[model samples]
Target: MSETLGRRGFLSAGIAAAISAQFAATHNEARAIEPIERNGQAKFKYSLAAYSYRGLLQGKAAELTMHDFVSDCARMGLEGTELTSYYFPADVTPEYLRDLKRHCFRLGLDVSGTAVGNDFGHADPQKLREQIEHVKHWVDNAAILGAPVIRIFAGHVPKGGSADDTHRQMVAAIDECC
Candidate 1:
C-alpha cells in the first residue's frame, strides 16, 4: 500500500517541507541579532540616497512617481531618502512640498538630500543668472524638504570655448552661488 502511494507525492511533500524549513531557519537567524546598543542605550541610524534608484527613473522610462519611489524605499527598510529634481512635477507648489514631507513621515522615511541639474557657466550673464536663480530655488526647496545637502552641476562648455575658460567660468559661477 505504501509503495502504491507513489513516489511523486512524497517527493513534492519533502521538497515543500525542506523549503519551509529553510525559510524558518533564515527567519530565526535574522531574529538572533541582539539590538544595537551603546552603554546600555539603543541607537538609531538612517541612510538613503536618490542615486540608488536612478536606474528606475531614467529619462522617459520612469513609470513610478516621486511618491511611489519613496514608498518603495520605505518598503526596502530604508529610513531616509534623497530626491532628484527630475522627479518633481513642473508645477510644484508649497502645499505639495509639505504634503510630500508629511507622506515621508507617515512612512517613517526622512528626506536626507536633494539633487538639481542646473548649470551656471554660460557666457551670457543673463543665462548665468537664470541658472543661478534656478539652483537657488532648488536649494530653498531642499531646505523645505528637510534635506541637508543639495547637489548642483557645472554647466557644459560651448564648442567654441576652451577648457581653461570653461573651468574659470564654472569656478566663477560657483562663487556667485556662494
Candidate 2:
C-alpha cells in the first residue's frame, strides 16, 4: 500500500509539472505577440493623410505648408504621407513637386501617395469630363512628386439621377482616368 501511494504521488507531480511548463511557454508566446516596432514579421506601414489636417491646411488663414505637414509626420514617426492635392499652391510647378520629394527623402519618409477630390458620378458630360481631368492632373502631379498612388472618391448620385446611372457614370469616368 505504501508503494502504491508513492507511485500515485509521483504521477500527480509529473502531470502538474508538465502543465506548469506548458502554461509558462504559452504565456511567453502571448507576450511575443504584442506588436513590436520594426519587427520583420510586422506587415503594416503607417502613413498620415494630409486631409487629416485640412483645417490647418486650407484657406487664406491656413498656417501649415505641406513641408510643415511632412515635418509633423516625421516627428510622429510616420513611415509615409499622403499629400492631398487641395493643399498644394495653385501655382505649383514641377520644381515645387521635385523639391517636396527631396524634402521627404531627406526626412526619411516616402510620399506614399496623393489624393484629389473628384466626383466621378457627375450626370453632365462636361462635369464628368472635368472630374476625369482633375484626377488625371493629380496623377501627373503624383508622378512628379514620386508618389505611387492617388486616392479618388466616387461621387454621390446627382439629384434626379438613378443609382444605376451614377454607378455607370462613375465607372466610365474611372475608365477615362485610367
Residue-level lDDT of model 1, residues 82-139, one tens digit each, is 8888678777877888888888989998887888887766878798888888887887
Candidate 1 deviant stretches above 4 angstroms:
1-48, 51-62
Candidate 2 lDDT tens digits, 1-83: 99998999999999999999999999999878655577367468899999999999999989999999999999999999999
Query: Residue 157 error for model 2, in Å?
Result: 0.6
Give each model a TM-score: 0.66, 0.75
- Whole-model lDDT, model 1: 0.81
Q: List, in order, the clash count of every candidate structure.
A: 0, 0
Best by lDDT: 2
Give the clash count for model 2.
0
> Model 2 off-target regions past 4 Å?
1-39
